[model samples]
Target: MIATNGDLERGAVDDQVVVRGAVGDDLAGILSVGHRTWLATYEPIAGPEYVAMGLAKWWTSDVVTDAIRKGRTLVAVLGDEVVGVATFGPQDDAVVLWKLYVLPGHHGLGIGSRLMDEVVVQARESGHDRITLSYLEGNEQAARFYARHGFTETHRETPGSGLPESVWMARELGEREQS
Candidate 1:
């Protein structure tokens, strides 16, 4: 259950949002963030069935616990509430961003951008050259967000199960988003 804080280091993103690695005490809040964001964002774009499958596969306590224990999960906290979550880890030659989601109500407040910034910082500190992520092809918001963060389309994959295509994207560590 990752009883200790797993050491990705911690910092405040701003006066309102504290960005930190997940601890055992954060399991419930992290799960809540994931469930809420998935329902609010993906249910509309990917359908209820797809949402159900995703929640079952990715939002479980066991999966999140594993991520937290690995020191690869970060949470954005607004006061005492968990408003966002991101999980990433080494994949081949780069870091693969397995998950990144901010609560719907918190969108446009720069929470996700702050999370991405920390991800790039951490990846560079860990000596990675690039980061990779994939979003559902139908999710235009995600597409725009990743593009704004300097990610470009690397490829696409049809997951075949009536699911939307996955639009894979990557960004080199040397690049920075235009502010």
Candidate 2:
């Protein structure tokens, strides 16, 4: 439902990227973004084994399809390419952002922020009081990005696999908007 496109100044030509709900057709692009970003972002920080474990476990057709079918996944597309992705849904008392990643080449281009803004809007519209997410401890980029979006660290959990601890963060939704 968060279908919106913005023209960003890139070199001399404008690039239009749209952020919208993911569909079954988006499975491949979603997987690609997840795989590329996972490799580029985590392979160094968490080691190749850790990155391999994640790719094997998370970046699968079945998982991405389920998220899309649930109507909780969003994808940022430039023309026909999936440049970024985010998926979230109810987790206990709050809406937990299960995943959010942008292609490394697309970083700092506001695509992630646009996806996040839509997530916050959707969460608020759904009557949620807060949005929670977790990032690997050493992913400073993620930590700073989420913090910039007003999320504060709540706790950390050790998943135990020679992997870094997952740092949980949350941002209060304040009040729900009247429909």
By lDDT, the best candidate is 1
Badly placed stretches (over 4 Å) of model 2 are 1-15, 175-179
| Candidate lDDT values, in order | 0.86, 0.85
For candidate 1, the 10 contiguous residues with the lowest summed lDDT are 1-10
- What is candidate 2's lDDT per residue for 1-179, written digit by digit as tens? 22233434442112477899999899999999999999999987899999898888888898889889999999988877898999999887789999999988777777888889889888878888899999998899999899888889999999886789999998888843221
Residue range 96-146, candidate 1, lDDT tens digits = 999999987677767898889888888998899899999998899999999
Every model's TM-score:
0.90, 0.88
Cα lDDT for residue 168, candidate 2: 96
What's the CA RMSD of model 1 in angstroms? 6.7
